[model samples]
Target: MADKSSSNAYWAANVRIILISLVIWFTCSFGFGILLRPMLSGISVGGTDLGFWFAQQGSILVFLVLIFFYAWKMGKIDAEHGVDE
Candidate 1:
């Protein structure tokens, strides 16, 4: 019973991390790239709007960083639960 509860807690934490990561991914890619582009247009990057950068490159970079961050964080979590691969 105790082991089952511990496993449930670990899985819950993993799911929470994934959900938060997805939210950030959506906000950066869709929110800033498209929906909020106009609001960010005032900020210039190489004579182009920051929105364009975010739409094109910024979000990709952010996603890559998030991938690494998630991997590292999850590794720590797995180790904490003694289930690391």
Candidate 2:
């Protein structure tokens, strides 16, 4: 019974982390890049408008960062759940 509950908690935490990461990625790639492009146009980054930068580079960078963050976070979660090797 305890093992089952801990397993459920681990999966719940994992799913929550995944959902948050996806939201961040989507907001950066689609929201800033498209929906809010006009609002961000006034800002500049790397000689391009903020929106363009996010569309072209920023989102990709954010995704890479998220990948690392997910791995690091999951490692901690695993440790907490006594699932780490």
Ten residues in a row with the worst lDDT in model 1?
Answer: 1-10
After superposition, the stretches of candidate 2 with alpha carbons farther than 4 Å from their true spots are none
Reference-based TM-score of each model: 0.93, 0.91
User: Can you tell me which runs of candidate 1 are displaced by over 4 Å?
Assistant: none
Please give, for residues 12-71, the per-residue lDDT of candidate 2 as tens digits. 999999999999999999999899999999898878799999988888999999999999
Best by lDDT: 2
What RMSD, rounded to one decimal, does every model reach?
1.6, 1.7
lDDT of 1 by residue, 10-69 (tens): 899899999999999999999899999999999999989988999999999999999999
The candidate 2 region of ten consecutive residues with least summed lDDT is: 1-10
List clash counts for every candidate, in order: 0, 0
lDDT of each: 0.91, 0.93
| Pairs in steric clash, model 1 | none
